[model samples]
Target: MIPIRAYVAADFAGVAELWRAVFPDDPPYSRAEVAIPAKLAVQPQYLLIATDGERVVGTASGGYDGTRGWLYAVAVAASHRRQGLGARLVQAVEARLAAAGCGKINLQVRAGNADVTGFYESLGYCVEPRVSMGKRLGVNAGGTGTSGP
Candidate 1:
């Protein structure tokens, strides 16, 4: 099994590349330069990466608000998909959140991302009756997200 472990300083570049390929539609604020430092300032340990020795092929990060856990930035390289790496990345984050006293976990997938819905369902995630809404605050307000790469 490929090792799933906490993120390290060296993972930034590898992760940036992995996400760029895996999630081409990701918003700017969620870019590596912004997200990495922001995550490191928070519960950094929840950021997990799947590595084959020196290459980062998968990534997932979680957050525990003391009640419900949040999952974000889950991605696996195109070549690594269908090999159980995505599920493993998510499971690793779930394990960490559970250890932190999180009773339930929540994640968001953009509307119409049906392709991945089945994958999450297989992992026991079910759709709930709630309409998701959000408002950008702070630096994300203008949608610039962050400065250039």
Candidate 2:
């Protein structure tokens, strides 16, 4: 198994290809070309990838928000699944979050993606009763980037 490492600019194409294959339902804005740079602008170190020599085979990203941490984009290529890469990816993010003083970590699996619930559960994650919500900052369609606007 390839050891996981931080993402590099050179890994862009491979990562993009891997994500397109793994998450075919993601929206346009979430495409690797758009999302990768946005993430790099912030906490790039938390963005990790596993590669087989030159091909990206896995990816996982984490975020620390002082009080809570989030695990995002945890995916392994279908060809690479069932070989413990998924578990390792999650564990890498968990280790980083723990190092940053995060006591709790949160992740959301789409309601339709029940198959992944068990995968996450095996990593010690549980489905909490709290509702998940989000608003893309600075976006159109009613949001104006101001709380009072």
Candidate closest to the true structure, highest lDDT: 1
Q: Residue 82 of candidate 1: its Cα lDDT? A: 94
Give the Cα error of residue 19 in candidate 1, in Å: 0.8
Model 1 over residues 44-147: C-alpha lDDT tens digits?
Answer: 99999999889999999999989799999999888788999999999999999998889899998777889788889999999998988776668676745343
Poorest 10 consecutive residues by lDDT, candidate 1:
140-149
CA lDDT of each prediction against the hidden true structure: 0.89, 0.86
Q: Report per-prediction Cα RMSD to one decimal.
A: 2.7, 4.1
Cα lDDT over the full model 1: 0.89
Each model's TM-score, in the order given?
Answer: 0.93, 0.91
lDDT (10s digit) by residue, model 2, range 1-115 = 6889999999999989988998887865677987899899988989999998888999999999899999989889998998999999989988998998999998989887877
